[model samples]
Target chain A: MHPIGTVHYLVLSVALLLIGTFGVLTRRNIVVILMSIELILNAANINLIAFSRAVDNVNGQVFAIFVIAVAVAEAAVGLGILIALFRNKETVLADEVDLLKW
Target chain B: MSQFYTSTDHFVLLPAIMLAIFGCAVLLLDFLFPEPKQRKVLALLVLAGLFFSGIGLWRQYSFLTSQGISEITAFRGTLTVDSFALFFNGIFIAVAALVAIVSYRYLELEGEHRGEYYGLILLAQTGMYFLATGTDLVTLFVGLETMALSFYILVGFLRGDKRSNEAAIKYLLLGAFSSGFLIYGFSLLYGISGSTKLRDIGAAIVSRDLWDPLVFMGLTATTVGLLFKISAVPFHMWAPDAYEGAPTTVTAYLAVGSKAASLAFLMRMFLGPFWNMKEIWEPMLIVIAVASMTLGNLAAITQNNVKRLLAYSSVSHAGYMLLGLIAGNETGIKGMMVYILVYTFMTLGAFLVVVGLRRMDVIGDDVDDLSGLMYKSPGYAVLMLIFMLSLAGIPPTAGFIGKYFIFLSLIQTGHYVLAVIATLYVAVAIYYYFRIVRSMFIADLVDKAPLASSVGLRVGLYITGALTLAIGVYPEPFLRMAQVSFGR
Candidate 1:
């Protein structure tokens, strides 16, 4: 059996990123879109950590830590906006939140 | 793995540090006061913070010049202080101050004069300062997020307004989605170069001869995020709705301050790290610029909402600025910087006039709302005419000077076809921009009521209007300033 390498990690990361991108484009529910965004970020985290170990440098790991912290802030803000929308229009679907469309 | 810094390094960071502290102070004071009328005090505090930061920035700029130090990279090259950053720092401070002044009357009119509005603007400006000055990918991403998160809340500040909430949600989702692309791209970039410092990455790529497919892919993905931030075409779907739905003052800040900061980051990364790969990236930018100009102008012609029209106009302006980057020379870069400064005034002044009309009887954001504006408020009509003509890139306004520099660089670089295409789009731009002026001056009056604009709104409008004309008439000083900015 082949041991895991940078290539394997990169492949996994790309696959997850593609999945998240698909969810963002296809899903109508805002919650699902938010989840997809999280998935996309986590995929980046996996790549960062993998490269940190592979390159014998901690910079990638440090970047991953910052990414995680920002993700938390982003999640809080996203949900807050989601709740605000739900309160006003009684919907969580992106299609329904279309009052300001050109 | 701790890094040490000297006192001078702290001095270098004074402006951003001052902005952050003042932001929190504004929030605390607002909480203590907690009255609608008292919100004006909070706005004043925010302005004072911005004022002091501007002073700090000026002192820093003089210190750098007097010391004869061209650039200083502190924290292991994570942050940089230089003339380029100082130029943007001035724009950010001015934009923040103007936004605060305009917000005072806007919040009062909406009867939602919360302290957080002012606090959030300061925080966002702080983030902008970092984005402009940061030298490392880590600093850049964190700064971008800080600004993005603040904008998310500010866009939805009017909780009772459905449009504002929708705008906030859309902006938040799209913004977060782009962050994912941005971070993944950063990871890949780090993976390739084994460093997060932009200079180190550029060095690594050059030393290793790493112009493989993966490197190109990583660069492309990273640019996608920056492109979205600047609202370039194919990535600008969120801007129109977000701009229209946001409070008009916040919309102005978004169109001016936030976009300028993003362009600062983009130029630093591309021209600094990716300069060696100019052959690849330049073509991509050219394509994006062309599409943005064509689509933005065509779309603006159909918009009835003035805010939406301005949003699309902002997109086209982004395209024009990109022309400078594609020029890949000193003249082009200077053109980009100058155009941003001029745009800050023209866009902000136009929005202030709209805010002025959002009074007791009229919300003057619709194109039709300006019908017979010369009768109701001749002063405002004339000011709006200056902004509209400037936006259309007519002469005798700063906008023309800005566009002239951009076109000069394009022609100098032999991008004649792109220049011609852009010129035709300028014609389309005039039709729509003049539509507003025609409605106000040429069209018949619908209402004879006098518009009541507050003193704050008047101050904001007059200052920006005066600056627009002053820069246009005497372009020499500004042109020299832009020339001196790059230190080349």
Candidate 2:
């Protein structure tokens, strides 16, 4: 097999990005949707790290670290909001949370 | 690292640093006070923070002007202190201050008055400062997340309301999703240029072919992300619900402050790295501009909820602002600055009226709730009328000046078709805006209670209404300000 390279990483990351986008669009479960968002973020992180290596630069890797930190903060906030929502609605289905719709 | 920072960096960053300090101070002081009556002191402290921040911004502006330079790069060129940032920062401070003032009584009425609310406002303003000034992708991304996270919490500040919680979740999910798109694009940009600086990226992009797949993907992804933040058509599903569910005070802030900050970010990205790629993105933005206006105005006609109606109108306003960007001339850029400033005040004034209608027992968000407002509060009703007229871009209001400049820029650029289409939508907008006016004057009262007026709310209304009229009647000073700010 050919050695894994930048293009391989790009292809893999693109797959993850597509899967994440599809999940976000189609999923009815809010928790699952949040996970899909995480996947998309991870996809970016992979792209950043791979590109950093390809370019012989550290800025992309630094950005990836930031992305990971931000992802954690985002997940914390997302779960907190989810708990708040669940407490009120007694359900986690996206379709059921429709109070503000026109 | 020592060489990376200097006194100039601290001086340039003073406003944002002050915001952070004051934000923390407010949070700490809240625990100490813990009394509803004493919370007003927190509001005063918040205002003090904004006042100092404004002073810092002014100092920066005057210093730059005196030096005969338009911009100064701080933090090794990661942050740019320029007329553009100063102008947008002024808008952010004004929006935050107004929201803080009006929020006091509204929050108290809802029994959710807390120190964290004011603290979050300050912190969010701090984030906006970075968005206006940051020249690096890292700084911009961090700043965006800071502002957006604060908003997510603020939107759900009223935990007792199920709608608020639901709105927060929806916003958080969608917001994070969009950031994913943005980061992906940013990563591509980093790979293409091997640097995070916008200048370097611009240099790299200028040498590439127009049909380069990487550049096209980066542009498309970045455009989607920024458009989502601005709540343009097709990406605006979160705005109406979030606006309807959030506290009215927060809704106003979300509508004006957040949109302004995102527009700043958009302008930075487009005018910096993507300037040479205009040919590729201009057609795409034109389509979005038309779709946003058409869909925004048309959908607003049917919205019975005032908040949702304003949300859609804000979307259409986004469309109008995009026309300025699409024109991409000095006049077009100035038009955008003028429009953003005008929009901040008029939109805030309109929401202030809605905030006044809120009482302990009244939801006051439905269109029918505005019935007989003329009889209940003639002064407020008249103020609302001026705001409606301004929003519809009628002459003798600030909004008219904004629209005029935009249309003029479009015509100057030979986009007469766009200019005419925009004018046609003004007529459609007038119809819905007048719907509220008709309900206020011609319809009978559903309730005889006076509006829930407070000192802070009255102050906010007066400032916004007066500015709305002042800018409309004598726009010379404001025009000069916009001209100076766009000089760079």
Candidate 3:
């Protein structure tokens, strides 16, 4: 019940990052993997904003805005690639996209 | 507003701006000239863009030398114009030009010769420029994404091929995932420094406790991200697959151009911000370097696919360059730069031969596909031999010069164990590299088809092959350039 603090935001964002990393590693669906990447990106955005406020500096906030724009671009490219894969392979499952072997 | 900008800023940005303008022009002109025959002009336009960009880089170099300064900062220090950037830009432009030239015939063969392909190469080179020059976190992150996004699209340029599609998605997922790690680290760095500029962050880190958890976490995350970009071991799962599946021309470009840019970025970050905590990161990189060399060489021995073999070989090359950095001496840094330049030509030359083998029916990526290449095309077969010998770090080739400096640096730094281990891997590398040679000369022909030769392909091969030998024979000038670029 103490006033919200930077440490509190750090903990929350770290949790989101861990969850996103976990999702990306464990998920089979390429779409889910892409969403997990978004979560990780948002987690970074939250950290940037929180730290910006803590330091009374605006660069981190500006960085967060850039991060948001970049995240959108990344998602667009990821999905475009996804659609292409689907067109050729007829599956969005990561397991099925395995034409090239290790 | 007048005070906020200056001629220096415009001057520093001119090269990248030129690349961007040409990139867009290529894209727009493609729309006007939809015919495949006309699309060939786009390749020439890309070369022109690269040519002009090279001129811009030369102007920057002359300005620095004439002013008797090593570097000039622009956009209020967000961008830096320096020998280090100029050196790497030289590599990127050379790689892009070679790739563009060879791509014409390959794309025509694939029937996917579109304008966007050349456009993306220019745009990616533009991104690499920022990566080499950017001193701010915002600039670096955007630059990395620009380069990565273009490569992702290019990897999948063969829209009809499933392998290309799969390679693109894998590359995209892993690349985006790595970027996530990179930005999370950058956020922590900003928090710790209260600024997004790398110099500010470095200054702040100098004052902080070495073992601070935030410092440790930020360092680890950033290292992971950069390592992933360079395809270091444990984070290199996407490399072989991407290299094997990508259009041969794009694969060569990705292997050389992208790796060179990422190495520039890595050197900037480590030597700039995280340099103070060398005690922590040096050991970590040591482990990564050893693992990369050991695993990369060992894994390569079993590959029948020449593309995958070269892919693994590149992974090992990354390890050798890391050793140069870990030495952390002037010689070590100079050696790293020299190695990158040498590696570019040899690797591209090797791939150019493979590209020539891509007849209308032949994928030509298998080891057996190279059987009796000596008999089929003696010019290309001899060129491939020089490339392989160079790759194996034999004397009288540019690769030996690179490896020699790297090992000498390690020995000078008293990393005798690491140097010996790295040298041992060259033996392993030779085993695989000669496998290609054996196939080309000793093995019987599987297919007697003549290589799909064109003026552009032959020209590209000649440039790469000649440089590979020229640098090896008279490395003094190139070595001096590397030393100068290292600012010594």
Candidate 4:
């Protein structure tokens, strides 16, 4: 059996990031957009942990933990803001929250 | 050889640690006294914490300079204390202090006097300190996110208002997207170099003579994230809404504090680890600089909302600072530092004026709100005139001095065409900046109500107003400080 390699990990990471980005850009549901952002962040974690294994170093793994903590905090704040918006507007569609614009 | 840790290792983080502690103290104080009016006490407490942190930073700065130590790296290169970081630390601390002062009465009148506001501001300042000083990519990422997350909550602090909620959500969605891009870029950088420390990354790239598609992609993604934070054109869609909808004081803090912090991070990252790859990133920055100036000034001309107009003006000022990066030399960096310092004074002073006019009856954020302001308060009107003129880059103001340094640096670097274009936009900017002035002095009074004033707002105006004029008159000390900030 062939060994797992950096290339394989990077391919998977990039794929996840692209999918997440696509979802964020295309989706209108605020909840889905938040989830998409989480996916993008998890994609980064995958890259960090994979590169940590390949590089034989702990820095990337340490960074991955930090990333996870920050992602959770971001999600909490993002949801709080979303809830605030929903309370006032009664909907979470991105287009409806258009009280401010050019 | 392995290195041993010592007491000095912890000393380097003293300012940030102290600031974090102060933030927690504010939270505790708020828990004890949950009354809205008690928020003023919390604000004063935050100021005291800021004062102590400022003194700590000053002592560290003095110690380092006195010992002739140009750089001190601690926590195994994750953090570096140097004049560059110290300079930015001072700016961030000053901004936090000034914002606290200005927000006092503004929050009281808006009925949004929550203790979390001061706590979050202090927390955000700590994050900014780390972002400016972090020498490791991991530290930088954490710091940036810390600052950004605090801002997300702060922007929506006025949760009762529909516009504030809208601003918060829009800023969050866009900000999170950009952070994803930034993190992915950092991941790629780590993969390519196999290190997260900036010095080690520079060494690895130089040793391998590395250049590849991945590197370019990573750099581009990182630049995009930073440009968004600074509200540069093509990435400035969130700024105007965020600025206009946020509580006036938060908008000022967001405008001056966040931009300076991100640019400080950008300068460190680009000039340190990626200096070898300048050719790849420099052209992209130049294009961003040009687009930001043109689009920012042109769009600002049509804005009737004063906050939105200043938001656009902030974008254009970001463009001017980017020119310093384009110069890509020592003088350029010095000029960038001076430009940001002066920009902080003028922008904050201008925003504080907007906040000064705010009352329960009137939002006081519209251009028409300023009509006949001269008749109501001659002192504030004169102060606004000074800030407006400075912002227009007219002579005898710090804004002019800042622009002069940037253009001179550009000319020194043979960016003649860019300088010429920037000057033309400065002319365009004057037209818009003067629009408010004309309304204040010439137009009929829309509402003859006496302008509401406060002690906090007055102090803020005086400090920033004096600094703007003083720097313009005697720029030698600031210029010298900028020169010394190379942190060599």
Candidate 5:
């Protein structure tokens, strides 16, 4: 109900970013990490839409749409890749991949 | 000249639409012919369809100019049809052709699903073409996603390969996270400015210091997200695994076509909408550019896998391109365009050699695998050297010219310190690049694979090689053309 301010976005951004960070740093499952990324994107979308609504400009919303589209596409390819990788490594843990580590 | 705006069906926008057509048509063809081999036929058709249409678009260059087809377009002023877009599209088209030709050998021998593979690539190219020419944020996003999504699938196309799959997954998750940041930035700008059009945003910021800190933050976050896409240093963790895991041809597409598309959009964004904010983005970019270069080169120095080395190298190059954008001058922009063109050739050529080496279960990926390439296959060794030297910025190669233009531009802008660092790294780069060259030539051949290729692939390699050499030797034409091409 209140006109959105930067704080609202900061809170949402912090939460989403924290989630993504936690997932990336500690997640055992690759799929879970990916889902966390989606959460982060959704959080961004929320912030964008809130700001867009506050600013009354369509660009933010338009960009959000593209973000969604890209997210879907990225997810499709990512899962396909995951499926492929699991087929080979038989595990989804991030630590399992050391084929190219220095 | 005032022909149409509401039509949304302009021939000027044919490349964008044609991609969707090719993508869907492949699906339809697959329905009609379900056999695995039929996928190849469909892929060929998609490539051919895109090729003919792309050539058709190129032919209309004169007509487009004379008729003022640009001014007669819709979306008000959100998109442009200037020589810049056409020039970029031309590069993209040439790239698509190279990839398409390479794919014939790459996908077939590697036994990837032709329908999904070629269709996604065509679709991605279409997105890139749109993104390159997109005047507004909306079209740019749409185009970028179309390409990005396809790439996600592409990076993981060889689902059989664990590394490829892991790479794809990592890229997707990180890529999406970054997209969120990018969109949030766009929204903040929109909120502050009340416009999606580049000109509108620029005009709003130019007339007054009404722009706010939040907007700057949004922009920075967005840049961070996109930084990942181009595989810039901090955002570059995904590239090596993805590059190594994905099919070699897909790696080329990511390195060449995808990066080109993103950079084109970034050029417009920084030089156009964000131009007024140069004081803000410049120093920030310089920090990033330095980081990307130093990190990428240093990391590359430690890599034994050829694919991973190239991946890190590309991340560093993306940083280099950013230097041009950081300068925020016409020369800076032109340098970026020139470097990208050269980058496309050198990176793609290097990858083609990688693709050439990947035979049966043996992917010609590791540094050790390249040992004694001189005796095993002198031709590939020479090609790899062109790639390595070009990458190292050696003279008589496109990489050198690309780096030279950026250095020249940076020096012109009084970034002597950064230039000094970049040059030092250039020296550092020589060692790693030479490591590959030495391995290919000096070391003994541990494993030798037959250089098997039909005429088309061999011809493709020759054309790519010749272009790499020709552009490297005589870059004036490219520089002039790139300068005259876009909204600048």
Candidate 6:
């Protein structure tokens, strides 16, 4: 029955960021890695929306809209890339594409 | 009173909207005229549209100011028409136009489709235009991503090349990684400041607890996210690989477009939104600046591929631009502006020369590929020298003057130690740039070179080369323009 506040946004971001970090470190699937990025972006959106209310400024939501648009574009372009890469390499393991690593 | 005509009347947005329109037209044109010869013609038409828009915007600025037009508000405060955006827009569009011309032959030599590549180039330029004038963080973010999205596709343009695909993948992965960091920072800033509007955040910070450690941490984290995009030392690991792997044209785009957009955003984020907490960011910038230059320059010395070498060189140049940021004066900003003008020409010119040589099978970016470049193509060799010397900050080239002013601006702010380190790195940079020069002149030719002097490529090279020299010799006019544009 506890009401959420700024702290709730913080906690959500922390958890979201943690999940993203875990995905980045442990995942082999390229698509999942990209999905983790979405989680990270959503965490940002939560904070922005929370702050928009707290500060009483309209710019926050506007900025959030831009973030969503950018994220959608990113997801589209990124998945297209994954498709292209998969077509060529036949697998999605991050470790498999190690030929160019410095 | 009027609606349709004023729909695009937000003075700051004119160039950006024009660019987007141009992008759409380029796409449709490419679809209609998919043949190689037709594609070239369409590319020229798109370039003409971009050129007309660029000139129209530039001329409008002079006319408005001379007539003393007062407060012509178009978008109801979402934007403002100013000299700053106009100047940067010109630079972005001009660079894109030149890149499109060079890319015509670049794709053709690789036996790739010429149709949509130039369209994407125009689209990416549109993104940069938006990013520069973005008064709101929302606009800024949108502009940035539009630019980045276009690049993701362009980086992988060469379907036949493994290096191109790998580069695209790496660029996509790291790019997405940075976006996550950027959003996280944005959220953190919003959380503490209680606003996502950039100016609102500035206002909020003034009243709120400046000494609060949590708020400070949030802002710092946000900077880390943005700096990764700019490729400062720790965050710069992806640049070399991406530059080495992508096709040369995409690399040129990254070297110019990505870096320029990040710089414009950095200026806005710091000067517009976060200027209140100078103490927090000043030291952070100094550390990043010093680290970025030393690491980028020292790394460039060992690179074998010319593209990778320029990639590292660019990271070092980012350090110079950061130095201008740390100076945090009108002159510093002006210096950064002028430096961008010069850098766009020379850096892109360097890549163009590489594309030209690569087309001739003379050089595909191996340092040794340029062995006896002077013997086979004297004109290209000289053109390459112009670019290298400019990049090296040597005399009689735009690079030198640009560096001098940036360092001068910082020194005026009494950051003598930082200035000294920056100067020393400039010395180290000379060695690498001269290495390319030495290869062109000193190394013996390995094989009989195949060379063609296309009128378009030669004209493009001449224009950029002449600009580099002109900026070096008579920089006063450009400097004055930069000062006026940056409102000194």
TM-scores across all candidates?
0.98, 0.99, 0.99, 0.98, 0.91, 0.94
Order of quality (lDDT)? 3, 2, 4, 1, 6, 5
Cα deviation at B484, candidate 1, in Å, is: 1.6
Evaluated against the true structure, the overall lDDT of model 2 is 0.93
Error of 4 at B472 (Å): 0.6
Give lDDT tens digits, candidate 6, residues B299-336: 99998899999999998998898898899887788889
DockQ-wise, the better of 4 and 5 is 4
Candidate 2 lDDT for residue B404 = 96
For model 3, the interface Cα RMSD in angstroms equals 0.6
Ranking by DockQ: 1, 3, 2, 4, 6, 5
Query: What DockQ was computed for model 5?
Result: 0.55
Question: What tier of docking accuracy does candidate 1 attain?
Answer: high
DockQ of each: 0.93, 0.87, 0.88, 0.86, 0.55, 0.65
**Candidate 2 vs candidate 3: which has greater DockQ?**
3
Cα lDDT of model 4 by residue, B1-488, tens digit: 13555566767888888899999999887877777766788888989989989888888888897899888888888899899998999899989999998897888888889889999999999999999899999999999998999999999999889999999999999999889988988887897788999888777666654467777777787788888888998899999999999999999999999999999998888888778888778888899999999999999999999999999999999999999989987878888999999999999999999999998889999999999989888899899999999999998999999999899989999999999999999999999999999999998877877767878889999999999999999999988888889753
Cα deviation at A31, candidate 1, in Å, is 0.6
Off by over 4 Å in 6: A56-62, B1-11, B67-74, B192-195, B360-363
Point out the higher-scoring one by TM-score: 2 or 4.
Answer: 2
The fnat of each candidate, in order, is: 0.93, 0.79, 0.80, 0.81, 0.69, 0.64
Clashing pairs in 2: none
Highest DockQ against the true fold, candidate: 1
For model 5, name the residue pairs that clash: A77-B152, A77-B153, A81-B165, A84-B159, B78-B135, B78-B136, B79-B135, B83-B485, B84-B485, B84-B486
lDDT of 6 by residue, A1-102 (tens): 988887787788779888987887689888888898888888778777777787787766777787887888888988887777778878788778765543
Please give the lDDT score at residue A5 for candidate 3. Answer: 98
For candidate 3, what is the lDDT? Answer: 0.93
- Evaluate all candidate structures by whole-model CA lDDT and list the values in order: 0.90, 0.93, 0.93, 0.90, 0.77, 0.79
Predictions: Cα RMSD each: 1.4, 1.0, 0.9, 1.6, 2.9, 2.4
The TM-score that candidate 3 achieves is 0.99
Error of 1 at B73 (Å): 1.7
* TM match of model 4 to true structure: 0.98
Give the TM-score of chain A, superposed on the true chain A, for all candidates in the order listed: 0.97, 0.96, 0.97, 0.96, 0.86, 0.91
TM-score of 6: 0.94
DockQ of 2: 0.87
